[model samples]
Target: MTGTRTQVVVVGGGQAGLAAGYHLRRLGVDFVILDAQSTPGGAWQHGWDTLHLFSPAPYSSLPGRPMPHQPGQVYPDAAHVVAYLSDYEKRYELPVQRPVLVQGIHRDGPLLQVRTDSGTWSAHAVISATGTWWRPFVPAVPGRRLFEGRHLHTVTYRAPADFAGQRVIVVGGGNSGAQIAADLTGHADVTWATARPPRFLADDIDGRALFDTATARRRALDNGQADTAGVAALGDIVAVPPVRAARDAGLLNAVPMFTRLTAPGPQWPDGSITRTDAVIWCTGFRPALAHLAPLHLRDRHGRIATTGTRALDEPRLHLLGYGDWTGPASATLIGVGRPAREAAREIKAILGPGHRPQG
Candidate 1:
């Protein structure tokens, strides 16, 4: 295998990886970002056509560059985000290798070996920023396989046109479910299903507010003070314009999660059946950590215990941008910078003064 060496090897060049690259560059650390995607924009490139941020452009930016504002757009759409990420990658000149599928990370003496389809990278530290977009989580509902109609997850959902004039069921109570259900309101006979009544945040609350709240909560906990409720106190769903409009039109109403799926549709608790033509699951995603399986870091709960972003069992391995476990709101574009900065600093400290960027 072709081999290369670096002081740090960052896995997954999404928002998190790019943020890490920025900080590492600022620290003069020799590192390369490995992205599985063929081009820039990371997971944003794969998002639904109409997907929009809950925040404005400024609040949705990466570490070094602000997302260029879209005229007349209060909440920028997915295309806007993709463009911003692509531009950010170029603007900072981050050392990112694309189309590099990382297969695993194994220990090699004092270094970690990042095995990728392209080649192997030996690094003193490895930052796994592989986000959750690839690992969409679909809850196992009884008789789901027996359903005859089209079934898809949030990852595969593109637009309402595909489900036009069909009876559709959207499952999950989060932002994806709300946005998707709202998108399908006029086009499809849609039923929004959730385990409980969906909670909507105040119209004023957006990504900025959510990040600030999470930061405050993290600070309070760190100082041994009373834990603040954080974003949960506000609500689950952010009432973005489309969702708000749908809610106002009385089309975004959600039903209780069905107990099981029948051939034609779902069976609710009261035995009421909805004859649905398709089911779109917006259930959310798990962290994409398959590459780290060789390290055996995950616990029984499928979580890697960490103090900040560094793995508790393997100090050389740092996990970034997974979610709250890595850092408060670290999964978001604006929120990833803090943890990335910290992780880069820690890696720099570990590498010490002897290691310098290779030419």
Candidate 2:
């Protein structure tokens, strides 16, 4: 209930935080993972029931363990991922404390102070792995408030049953949009709105391929070289069964986003109106960096400029698993392990070998 001191304190106990814990444990540092969620599995636990990873078992796993699945099983669903993350937590015995809502973080002389709703923690360094899931971002469009239909972001979306018998518009061109649209097409009259054409990898493509491709592109871009590899981005839709089925059934069509929302529905650029019942926004999220605002590392938006997951200006803080800006493919279950390892080593180098907890 009072301030708990440690050498290192990791905020956000999702995949990125868990991955960082894996490395910090190996580094033999005294640390604790402060999780906002009461349960394990991080943000993955909140995805829709039918949501799935684009990669096979091995590719979707963390650094220490391969995701378990029956022989020949490729993509895993939300439940399996959650179970694996829960089991991974128990298997490693990571020092995790749940339901610890971090309210603010600021530098206190040589140490960083973490103030939480329940208590406080002082650490030599802090790692902010708070992924973007909690901060769903829906872009501002004219007349958005005029729509009388139901509006929901993917964060609250759980299943397709709630949307039955309605004309729905699934907005955004990424995997969530694709999957959610696919799930609803069978039950509702669905229209898809995307800023750009949704690109799909070949049926055989998976997360591993996407990560490799993204890494290649990043490396090339950093070196000022052209991207020779014709690889798609990680955000590009993977043709999962439901999405593929939707594609085959001619229901995966996407139109450019409408100019604005109307009383009845969407108003297109040509002034055409489409009557709609509900809108499910899969537009994505911004980083959850409100707690770090006291640090003065973020910009006008809640975005912190980072040097390979480390704050570009702050020496004692590192961010992980929000997106590529943190590290290559850092947002994925597979991609987070590398950044976690590197960030832990960076902290170890800065804070010395073993740290004794101080109150």
Candidate 3:
């Protein structure tokens, strides 16, 4: 019912949205950020208690401010990251409105109309930074609905203590699965399952190295050189401290994915069954873009075609922090900065001289 106007509206006040806000403010763009969460930490607030960054604090920061180092921590944990984000927003006094659930984004003449639970915002450009946490992806494994045991996803997983003494199967070969399985090593009877063998990056490699690798690949492509190997070429898992220790202890071995989910547990391809009390799915997530469905911009491949961060079909809309499709490593804290900067610059160009913030 209520209505507001701004030059730009950034949806989702998470890391990506914050990065965009930093650049837009620097460029004197009159904008506002709407966050679905009530607080400043974004999705980091929901990460499991023991979750930690693969890179050190300085290597994982936004555009204008570096995350403060947590004493006695090489790789900061989830709580530390949340505290840093809370501080970063206040340090810059970024204009952020919280607890506003965006319903949809629609076109209105020359402006984009963002309808939310609290109110509506009309802006020349809109950046959808609503990352994937809200939409956890679980593959439709046959018989999943028939399973009698508890089924959980990475988003809902809190701590290993919750599943103490229970037999659990962790599905997925990615970092989350490895990390969760490691956490549950002593707490639960757990089995790690992946479609293929788990790939671990060199023990010495961390997120900082992976970020650098992605940056190099981007540069090589920009210069018209042959594509270089990226983080994926190195491995899937980052081998964070816990995971490394678990692997070294021989407690983190992964088995092949189950062919089907039985009432009690999972059935292997050979028809052998593993009776389990619960199954935790760390399969991964898709972008949280349901609000953009009204725009119908996604291609047949279920992706929004984009030139850098700007959507190809809808030039006034920009997608940030989705992943490499928006910009190299755009989903990571340090990586999201480049694309956010580029998106802000592009919005400024599109809005032209008249839309600059008033002195």
Candidate 4:
């Protein structure tokens, strides 16, 4: 009963979207995948050059393909990862309709309507595999506009050479900040600002598995330390010092996260100021669901309500890659696959072949 329709529509073509597409194909489901980027790999292709996932190779690989590295080896680079995603797309022949930015998803009677630049399409079910980094988190630091130098967010960061010889301040203690600081320190004067000096972990430390910090943090959170210990202690965000250890080597200075960024630079708790030529905000990201206004679905924290591992409340709407607040695996490359596969299975089971209305 439609001019254009699919059994399932997957929004996003990153690792999560690709994984969902792969499993949907395996189950003999009819589906279409959509991505905003010209190609796949989502935001990975656009990240900083020195980036290798914090997770080891084994933990980062997708469902079927091997990562071409030893289990615990650090991944090659961003380009290599992007190439692999491209290969994944070709191997499975996932029907990814790309360069088609999805504007929104709304219900057209009983059918879910996906609005895109090309046209509107209807689907029995929809899987949104959009990653956690939907929107870059840039705070409104006062006097930021007064700064004369070129300011950029981590989203715009591509390589270290661009910031060479520049005085750069990285504002965050997460993995991204650490990695960027490590890379920039070799060529630029880099300063890292955080609320507290994080207890750093490495890919491996002292030849032993660096699992205790994460395990302890998780246990504490589960035991109701989520609120009491606060964001600094939870270690929800990765605080691993980069392999190069730029902070330890004095190439980068770790400053306490302070309040009020002045025209001169960041102000610390102890009446100190750090001057910088440029500031790269590694604050974090928030989901951009402004397009989902019609759905009227939200959680306590103003995020879209999702459960059953990204399975949405509406009969046809589902979510993927929403494990941001979950466990260690929630936001990792390999972590997204489970929810994606489950969404595909749920779509297939709910809308078996004959459910399609006659034209």
Candidate 5:
């Protein structure tokens, strides 16, 4: 396959990229997903070994396909997720070119040239679904660089056994911080630090409720009604088994962020410094848009501006799964499908009614 013939080129091959490919395939649009990884799992394949979807199987699935899970099980782990994504591509026969690292994209008169390590993919439209896992952001404290203790972002963290018998500070208020802190409890003395007080949802309320609330919020916004419901960022942390266990063990509590870093640990404003062996920064990620730098699609905040799934400036370029700017919960497995289908539809509409590529 060559760049001159393909109609759409989807980037990333993660859940967001897969969802977009599914919709484009249904339309018979000659498209291909460029995946940097050798295998089918997106960031999930690179996630922590114990990572599981916060939502249940029903809500965590892609469009048209229910993720295969144990009959009574609700959440599937990282390995299970990778298997499902691999099978999904085979089931739909989605055109995915893996082990291909896309370097950049540029406008070439009528077509967009997607330059990659293997070759350039010239297409009428390009959908970038490259997610945030590659770009983790850790806030800088005054004396952070002076600390000699070991430091790692969530991207490099995997097992708790490595930190056994040590005092660890897990930073960030999101689910990653909570889950990692919980995992470290038995192995290490853990202190959960957050920019603000960590909010925990009721034990029974899970991701199902979070998705429903997001849906309702989207509906209200679509209808132009002011509906401020749950927390702005999905409903707090889901009460996963591990998190619940941590709570029961009195390890789920969070403390205010430390003022600065000491040689061995973080120092509070009260002049008390707690000795910390390691710091696991579970801080969230920024949008990974380095490949699109030549396109100049980002703002000062390093965000690609989009109206729904469509680019605010370039009509043929679409960005999926970055965040709410693309669609409601656009980064999630379930949420990504809506923007994917919409982008495919818009591409077909722009290219005329009969632009079918040989499958």
Candidate 6:
């Protein structure tokens, strides 16, 4: 394990990383991509095999390639998306070095040192496209040490098959929890606990209510009225009023949130209690930037600070797939295209055309 040097290094081989790599390749910049996974597609590959993108193919495709599915259809299963990413790399010949976990990133004089499990890579600039899903967030509850049933984070979940005939409680109300609850109803006694339920949207027949919800949140954020607390209080802004009305009509019971988890079971705010055999924590994620101590880049909330879609620490570092950057559009595929292009353009200006590295 010797050290390698490059002009630029992109971390994480998921869609965002690949998008950056693709643009860098076209620009002929000298760059390398480092990813922890054995293959590409990031979290998508680890998700349940049957999972498909909520977005249609038209909106899900990356810059240079069309999604392999019909334009308006639901994107294929995880494997298909994985294959698409593989096809993308092969089709464009992007340089991706996989199975490398970035251990630390530090400033080595004018250049940056990226330490991986294999070795160190030196680059003038680094694009950290590692999205926010790697870290599973399970809250610390009182007496959690006492109650012991099989508990796991949503990140490790592969299928609902194991929960069959078992009583399961899913914590957190994000898409993962909601989907898990809906999926488990047939085989298991499932109870979902969320501090605040997400605003669930109906299928395409209801149109882009999800986008509208995003827009409202964006408006709130722009007004400086919505922080983490604000977003949580707002509930599912993506679902239409009618959908909420319909949901209230008894598709599912939205229980009052749980107040505490005793050793035996969880106690809800209503003074009632329920027992569970297992708990699936779908609580959100924090940044996977723990290895980046050398740069000292973070906001007051302990998140990587971005300036107009670029990291404030350096011109070469960029963050994509964040739900709230410039606005509500920041996290979506179409929304990320502009920022990705801009990052490429700036890196190309520094490295020159063809993404070719400087010797």
TM-score of 4: 0.84
The per-prediction tally of clashing pairs is 0, 0, 0, 2, 1, 13
TM-score of candidate 1 versus the correct structure, residues matched by position: 0.98
Runs with alpha carbons beyond 4 Å of true place in candidate 3: 356-359
Clashing pairs in 5: 3-122
Q: 1-359 in candidate 1: lDDT tens per residue? A: 46888899999988999999999999999999999999888898898989999999999988878888899899998888888888888888988998999999999988899999989999999999999999999998999998999999999999999998999999999999999999998899999999999999999999999999999999999999997788988899999999999999988999899999999899999998888899999999999999999999888999999999999999999999998989999999999999999999999999998786342
TM-scores for the candidates: 0.98, 0.95, 0.97, 0.84, 0.95, 0.84
lDDT of each: 0.93, 0.88, 0.93, 0.70, 0.85, 0.69
- Give the runs in model 5 whose Cα sits over 4 Å from its true position: 1-4, 229-235, 356-359
**RMSD in Å for candidate 5, one decimal?**
1.9
Between candidates 2 and 4, which one is better according to TM-score?
Answer: 2
Candidate 1 off by > 4 Å = 357-359
C-alpha RMSD for every candidate: 1.2, 1.8, 1.6, 4.2, 1.9, 4.2
Name the TM-score of candidate 6: 0.84
User: Over the stretch 1-359, how does candidate 4's per-residue lDDT look in tens digits?
Assistant: 12468778888888878888898889888788988899777878888877776555555667787666634445456777787788888888989988988888898887888888788778877877677566888888766776666778888888889988878888887767777878887788877877667456433441112233434555676677754333234343343445356655766567777677777777777878777788888888875555566777876778765555543567577766655442334445666566567677777888776565333
Residue lDDT tens for model 3, 1-359: 47788899999899999999999999889999999999989899999889999999999999989988899999999999999989889988889998899999999988888999988888889999999999999999999998999999999999999999999999999999999999999999999999999999998898889988998898888899988767789989999999999999999999989999989889998999888899999999999999999899988889999999999999999999998889999999999999999999999988887665222
Model 6 per-residue lDDT at 219: 62
